[model samples]
Target: MLIEPLLEIRDVSKTFPQPRTLLEVLARQPKRTLHALRGVSLMLRPGETLGIVGESGCGKSTLGRCLAGLHTPEGGEILWRRQPLSDIRRADRSRRIQMVFQDPYSSLNPRMTIAQMLDEVLFVHAPSMSSAERRDRTDSLLQMVGLSPGLKNRLPHAFSGGQRQRISIARALALEPEVLVADEPVSALDVSVQAQIINLLESLREKLGISIIFIAHDLNVVRHISHRVAVMYLGQIVETAATETLFGNPQHPYTQALLSAIPVPDPDIRSLQVGVQGELPDPLSPPPGCGFSTRCPFVMDKCEKPIPEFFDSGGEHHVRCIRAHSSTFSVPA
Candidate 1:
């Protein structure tokens, strides 16, 4: 049987106009525009976590904001269970998808206590619920995220960074959303804390049957949290595959470089950095053809023309590279 995905983002794109200086403006000129997301598409199934991994400025956060309705997409549609996301009723859509920001410190309101924060979420989505029911749900959420309900009286400033994130999670779950778009959820925490949050998110998915679109710059961390991972360079997803396949056997040159950069925790495995050298290209105006072609070590003439079709290399793995299909391109051993 075929199962329809909980969310589908189709051919989505977002472009932001760059700010111009006084001189440039006076001269009747405009600063170049930034193409944040260029035709990005993906699906999120029920009870599954899909990770989007890339470096900073790769537009992963931009994509998250768009899906969260914080930023409107310039083109294409974001569908929630086969219905257009924008056209749906606001109250109805809010229950379907929620966002958990990367930094817990800034996300929470310092003026509001934990109880107040949680109550706000409930008020927006479940206003009719009695005070007792809202309190019970909030308490349950706090405990589920490994927090204490008694701390509800404390302001966000009173808690540690990790605790604040737990509160953020509790608030996101207040609406019982089917899909959670977590943007770099643990990037701001200490290494030890990062692990705890990742584990907590993983545990919550299956228990709640909540699909998650997990965004992180760290490939290793994304690999740990996601069932499938998509590797993005600049503003485009170069490759996507099941967790094991993407790490064990990456197809795109950029994906290989990214995986190779991940440090092997074990002394048994080699600790050399096999990552690509040089700076990332400008997103304002990407290369003429393939966005990664400039950084791709295996650049070819055909690659300069245009990106090849997004092809599946058996199973659910897909890569947007000519090399994936043709022997014309091969990684040097």
Candidate 2:
């Protein structure tokens, strides 16, 4: 049986103008822009968690923002349930998609009590609900995220870091969104707290059956929660496959380098670790051809000619590297 995607993104691209200082502007300097996302496309199935992992400055957060309607893509189509995202009513869009930001402290308002915060969401989405009904729903939202209803009267500052994150999650759930785009939700918390939050998310997903787009730099966390993984590089998806296939049989050189860099627990293997060399190219003036060519150990003359389109190796495991087709190709350890 074929399953239709809950959401689809096709040929999406976004760019931001680079800011110039007053002196440069006065001198009539040519304006430049950062290529944040380029021809990106992906499918998200209902009730499935898709994990997007990449290095810093790779535009992971920008992609998330585009999906959540925070940034409009200059090109390409975003469809929700086969309907154009732009055509969807604003109120319906809010109820169907929600975002959980990285910093819980910064995302919440300090002046508003927890109850008031949730109440505002209900006020906008469920305006007809009576005060008593709204209060009941707010309490339910608090308890849904493992927070106590009693804490609704307190301000955000009174809670611990983990508790504050739980509140953020609760606010997102208040709208009853079908899709949740969580951009580094646990990255700012302590390591122990991160585990707690990750577990909470997993539990919530099972209970609510909501689809999630989890964006983060931590491979282990992505591996634990994501059914499939998409590795991004320089604003483009380089590889995507089932989590086990990606970890056990990585094909692209970039993916291989990332897997090799995961820290091994054995002290004997610690000294033998290897990582990718060279820094990422500047986005404002990216090099021609493949973005990973400069750092790819298996670089070829063909790689410098043009960027390769994604090709399925087998079983829908797709890769963009031209060298990925060669059975003998391998990244040096």
Candidate 3:
């Protein structure tokens, strides 16, 4: 039997207007906008983690927002198990897609206590839950996320970044969502705290079988958590493969550059490596062809034209690069 993927996005697109000057904007025709995401297609299986890794301004966050319905795509389809998500009933939708944002300290309201926050979710998603049941579940959630019921009365200011993030996870899990969309969830925390949260998420996935779309700028952080990884660059996925395949034998130049940047922990090896070159290309009216062509070391003349279509890199592995499908370029030693 074919394993039916839980989430599917097809040709999703989002663009934002770029106005250089007030006079220019008013006098001339409407100018080009930042194409935050362009014709992006992807699939997520149930109870699996698909890591989205990219540098800043590469549209990783925008795609996360689109997947969680925080920002509707201007084009394309978002489907959950073959059914269009846009057509999902509101009540079901609430219990289906949940988001855990970065900066938990800011995501919470200063006025609401932990109990109140969890209660609100219960009220919206499970109103049938009695006050006693809601209170009971609140405690359960706190414990589940490694927080304490004793701290339930405290405000956001009382907890450290890690603790606050735990609360955020508790709240996201409150409705027992089928899919958790996390956007830079650990980027704002200390390294130790980041590890704890990552561990917690992995444990929860095992225990609850909830699917996760984990988005982060650091591929190293996602290395342990993701089953499959998709590398994004300037509004498109340059390569996608299993975690082992991606890290060990990357196909796309962008993916290779990203891997090369991962700092070697050993001091002796640190001095030997190089990094990706050039500043990120302007997203507004992105270049005619492969966006990374401007910086790619092995870019061919074909790269200056329209990007080659996604090419197969064997079973379940895909890469979008002329070099990827061409017989000419060999993997660097």
Instruction: Give the per-residue lDDT of model 3 (tens digit) for 3-107.
Output: 799999888888887766878767886676889998898999999999999989999889988877778889889998999988998678768889999999889
- In model 3, pairs of residues that clash are none
Per-model TM-score on C-alpha atoms = 0.94, 0.94, 0.94
* lDDT for position 155 in model 1: 94
Give the TM-score (vs. native) of candidate 3: 0.94
| Model 2 lDDT on a 0 to 1 scale | 0.88
Q: Which TM-score value belongs to model 2?
A: 0.94
Residue 230, model 2: lDDT of 92
Number of colliding residue pairs in each model:
0, 0, 0
Error of 3 at 333 (Å): 5.3
Global lDDT scores for all candidate models: 0.86, 0.88, 0.88
Q: What is the lDDT of residue 89 in candidate 1?
A: 87
State the lDDT at 78 in candidate 2: 93
